[model samples]
Target: SAPVAAAPGDNYVVDDALTGSRTRWFDEARFGMFIHFGPYAVYQGQYGSCRDAEWIKRQCNISWSDYEAKAASFNPASFDANAIVQLAKQAGQKYIVITSKHHDGFAMWPTRVNRWNLRDHAGFSRDLLRELKDAATANGIKLGFYYSIWDWHDPDFVGNFPAYVTKMKAQLQELVTNYDPALLWFDGEWTETNPTNPWSEQNGEDLERFVRTISPQVITNNRIGKRRLVDGDYGTPEQSLAGSPPSAQLQETCLTINNTWGYAAWDASFKSPTQLVRDLATLTSNGANLLLNIGPTPTGTVSAGQSGALTGMGTWMAVNGAAITGAGYTGLVGQPSWGKVTRKGNKLYLIVNSWASTLHLSRRSPFTVTGARVLGSASPVTVRAAGDGYDFLPSGGATNAIATVIEADIATPA
Candidate 1:
């Protein structure tokens, strides 16, 4: 989504002090866990060649009545909220964001506004949101909710646009007041595809205003109105890292561990742990948070392959987390051929994804190094002045299996 510039004299301003604090906390928490589990898990994106299982109703072109019947059978008895939170903690994620309501309009929590939610319509008797929220709180992990504005099942949304907006507000009130999510990731604001009835950007802004009134501290994404960087607290870049590094707003890069955001029975192509860590490092160096997603199976359990990948990432974070946490783009230069760079205060962390006994910095670096050492270890790396840049010679044992983080004490040019 392209970022839109802020309008002149816009009154919809977030409290600067609160926004600054929240932004700092968000940036320091570089990695977050994204769960996309819903009734769609039952379909697993297996309807023909469609990959988004979460949108199976639309993908399969199922009638509303049939989809409602399908919701009646939805039961995730094996869902272990504590287990999921534990796995996220093990993966070194500072926050967890789960889908309370996807585009399918199936609310994970009990809602008074609609009976189509999990507690009222589906066979599940438990409130998934409450369970996950409680577990996240117990574990000291910040919790966020993903809410989609488009609801195919709601008749109000189908025929009455204004009524639909009111219902949406009521539901948002329920979520914010009951659960208190740290962030509210809104989607489907561009529900303009429906030729019969189109949702407008003004409606989105009004909805956002209501959300803020209820929960002023909650962070929101740009997808609510005009999918743009300045539209919300952060830029929600999904699937790929295509945009130039976000400067005016907080930035997040959301990606699935595999090809699909929702679980797919036929989709087994999972990204390697090494690649995941590299992406995390690269995003961190670019001053963006990585919201890595894991689509749980229909049985409410994360796939073994996905868990293994996260575990591998945990191993990497165990050693080189200093390079990520509380770090941001150094503004030294673009990402180097070898890897990336993140900075905190006077320290520069050179993340070496491709190991070399001797590494050379770009001529863009204007700092003199007093000392160099591998992060998380005291093993020193020899640094000497090159003509324009600097060269780092690693002491034999100063390396990590995935990415070696070298911390340099830099003296900036006067």
Candidate 2:
């Protein structure tokens, strides 16, 4: 696929956070939710997370006709898409990214290009995608789509590369036209023949160019080569990252609430709310965003535990979201064991990860401490001008493990 070079547009630079466009907006979001659910949840007995190969093998071992049979019994009449979207918003997430299709080749929405979509093959007649889209729009959360490039059922793509690109283009065009997605996450790019492989730079660059051309505001994953996929965009890294996003730009790391991206029945590696909160704080302090994921059940119902965790985090966000959102790195002067740092105007956020009796630290940062207060609990904390630096014991309560907010006046670097 030769790159279809398009005329330049949207002069916004996403390469660095300060002079950025979409990256800045996404980074400002701080915490966004990733939804990965489908008919596969019903097969909890056979399938698991999308991350494991064994689960895939077990499920794929069955013939397509047999798998399609699951659709008949897949009655998620309990699906409350609005409630799920509501949960995301309540969780203080700024965006919602859903899996439109997985490797199983089952489409969540009706597709003109492929009839093997949820509306036709599955017994469910309703439109989950449209429902989710409406729900997200109503809640003020930006919507994005995750369409796996690897379609096991598509003969052109399954174990075949040369023919897959053409099919992909058509499917992508359909998605772009119908859903004005803000982000496009393309995964399942590795080859089964040789697992340790990715597409050539030419193919990758072409695909990335195609996406940029289609949606001027759309951002893409780093799975592709020589683009933002490998580069940091405002420091937000989605999926996985070898390191944090570059400081000049916003960076983010997208990880799952559980070990799996898609709904997995037996996947019990659910992350605690504390862990999630801590991870978000750590990333934000380092000038990054955290794209947390959740997989909805086939009938569009999110698990109770998942919902609870999200709401729990939301409760904390309600009181402390200001520190997490749109704040820059504290530059820490240097790293300290207390935790990480985030700053907004004159306020500096020190997210102490440890639970020590007292915190002892020193720093000569380009900022002046004016005041300090704990989030969730607005009580004054104590700070002292330590020798050649400063020290403080931040306030904490049963509500959260993270420490209090430290107000500081940032001075221009000399």
Candidate 3:
């Protein structure tokens, strides 16, 4: 698919008021983890023709009573906060955003406003969100919460809409006050099934203002209202990366490790480590962040396949992370056919996706090349002035099986 152009009122405008000092950290963080966990995992995408994970209730036409009953058996006994945090650290992720309350209206934390939560409804004793907060703080990882405005189990959502909003605000207060998350990722605001979602732009603005009053510095996504720039601090491009408004707009691409956001017993289409690394590099090169997702099983353990893929990415990050962390699109050079480019001050990291004997720049660059070398390795690369551009010749073959980065030291004409 082609990239979408930004239109008027598309919310691509950069609002300095909404994006405070925290936006810098978010941009440089580069990579983060997105966890989708709830009672829906119990179903494991088992609905006959629906075959959906998180949206199984609505898609499969499951009765509300039957869907609510899954909560009783939804004890994720093996959910280890420390292990999950450790996995994020191992994957070189700086932050984490877990589903606090999804569309099913099942809250992961024990909310004072309602008993439809992990603790009260599922008969679980431990506070899952609190445990994660502790683990994240101890590990030096920023934590965020994913909340859904749409409620399937709540009666007020369909009966008394304003009452539902009141309850929603109360729940948001509980999450921010208790957990102190660094960000809030909202969803389920789109009017897909319900022609009239009842969640108006005014409602979203009110909620955004209310959130700032509580946690003034916390970050938020565009889904808060109509997926517009004014609704939140940044845009969330889901599943596909082609929907980015423009390079100037702040956006994060949220993608799943496999086909589903929640555990699906038969969905085995997992992206390889090479592809994941390339995707991260490409997104970073485009001045966007990647929030890779993982759907943990009902047992609360990440499958070996998912863990292994993350480990592979971690292995690469351990060596060449400098090329990614804090790097941004420079626009100094056109995107090369063989690879992508990221920059930090005078250094240009040429990320070669498809290895070649001699990588040439698409056009003549203004910055003069001083020196070049393979990132994560001491091997020097030979640079020569070619026709209208420069060519980079590596001493040997690609260093890493995945994308091998060449750090080019450049200087402007003095």
Candidate 4:
């Protein structure tokens, strides 16, 4: 008889010890910064017209020797860890996840497992990860590491897969032991067909288990084990938003600010600050966190366009952050065409994207609206009982042009 398959939530049974305070912190951290800095940044996501990104080495089909040579000259002189963390705080991001090792197989931190790392190969003086961890700690921000399981530079990856896994484990041990990261975000688990990527489901499980043994307190993502709901502590939907909440109790959507995850000098298409704020509200409404990405330039500085967008977002978060941070899904009111809804206790925040003179709630809504007011403003919104249900009328136009949040006080139905 075929082996019985595990139930929906049984594939990766988390140790009760792992999901204590750390998991709670993660759930409450509604927004975070994802840094994609690697050798690929040197290329600026361009190879003539190919438009390569973090996968520039594979996408452009560059020879290994050429890639290595280019990597040797990689030196980011202006990398400021404190400044980055400060920016995160300004943007109302409680946490950050930076790439420790991308698929290119270059470790940002000094690693003894291999010389193909920042300190040894690139001849860089500073420990990038250590600087970030220290800055994050000082700024009261949680720091996580994003490591790619696939290795393009490792010679043993194709010939002796287990040897590669052992090296990977050693590198991971270094990160967990030295950095003490709050989270470990794994990626590059997909089994591609071209060279026949050999990453297997069992590998993911074993790696996850190994991570727990070393640091039971750290949170990990589904990519650590087969990209399934049961693989790790939470589900990670990349490059796009999840249409609905995933089967995993905890989910995070990772999206790039521009078209590419790595620094693309020519890619000027960036989402407006209003759109990002709205995205945050939408994700929070579904009980999901948003991990927005930033691709730093070769000089180790955020581009003007990216930083400007982040500044704009920071401005909005300064005013209406309560609507996002620590907020969760509230089924009392269905999603309205005007905007999204998020709740914290008896407070239901209406993130109005399209301002209207009046907002209506159906009679069947599960909660009674007691009062309403603009989130960041001193003025109160008039709440009245209507024949159909409840009506909310703001005193004036939206206080914020991007997305105006109205705090609605509610009482549970009897």
Descending-TM-score candidate ranking: 4, 3, 1, 2
lDDT of 4: 0.86
Q: 269 in model 3: Cα distance from truth in Å?
A: 1.0
In candidate 2, stretches whose alpha carbon ends up further than 4 angstroms from where it belongs are 1-19, 45-60, 158-163, 191-198, 226-250, 355-361, 393-404, 407-414
Clash-forming residue pairs, model 4: none
Per residue, candidate 3 scores C-alpha lDDT tens digits across 1-414 of 122454455563333344547687888888999999999999988966678899899889998788878878898999999999999898888899999999999999999899999889888989889999999999999999999998888989988999999999899999988889999999988884575478777777777777877776789888887744255877788987663323555778999988899888888888998999888888888888899998999978888878888889999888878778898776677778987888888888998988888999855447888999997777779999888778999987888989899999999766
lDDT of 1 by residue, 1-414 (tens): 122344453333333345656566787999999999888887767756555678788888877877777678878888999999988888889899999889888888999987888889885888888999999999989999998888877777778989988888888899999999999898887746766446676776676677767876888887767643126678788987655553656789999898888888877898999899999988888888999999998878899888889999988888878888888888775567898888887888999988788888875757678888887777678998775688888876536778889988887887
lDDT of 4 by residue, 1-414 (tens): 122344455565445543646599988989999999998898888776777889888998888888888889889889999999999999999999999999899999999998998889999989989999999999999999999998888978888999999999999999999999999999988865547468886787788778878897899988887754237778888876665643345889998888889898988999889888888898998989999999999879998778888899999999899899999787666778899888888898989998888987654566688888897788779988876677789988889989999988899966
Q: Against the true structure, whose TM-score is highest?
A: 4
- lDDT on C-alpha atoms for all candidate structures: 0.81, 0.65, 0.85, 0.86
lDDT per residue for candidate 2 within 254-285, as digits (tens), equals 88777766666666767777777777777777
* Least accurate 10 contiguous residues by lDDT in model 3: 1-10
lDDT of 3 at 328: 76
Model 3 lDDT at residue 199: 78
For model 1, name the residue pairs that clash. Answer: 3-229
Candidate 2 matches the true fold with a TM-score of 0.83
TM-score for predicted model 3 compared with the true structure: 0.93
Candidate 2: deviation at residue 153, Å?
1.3
Alpha-carbon lDDT of model 3 = 0.85
- The number of the candidate with the highest lDDT is 4
Better of 2 and 3 by lDDT: 3
* Clash count, one per candidate: 1, 18, 1, 0
lDDT of 2 at 324: 88
Per-residue lDDT, model 2, residue 294, is 76
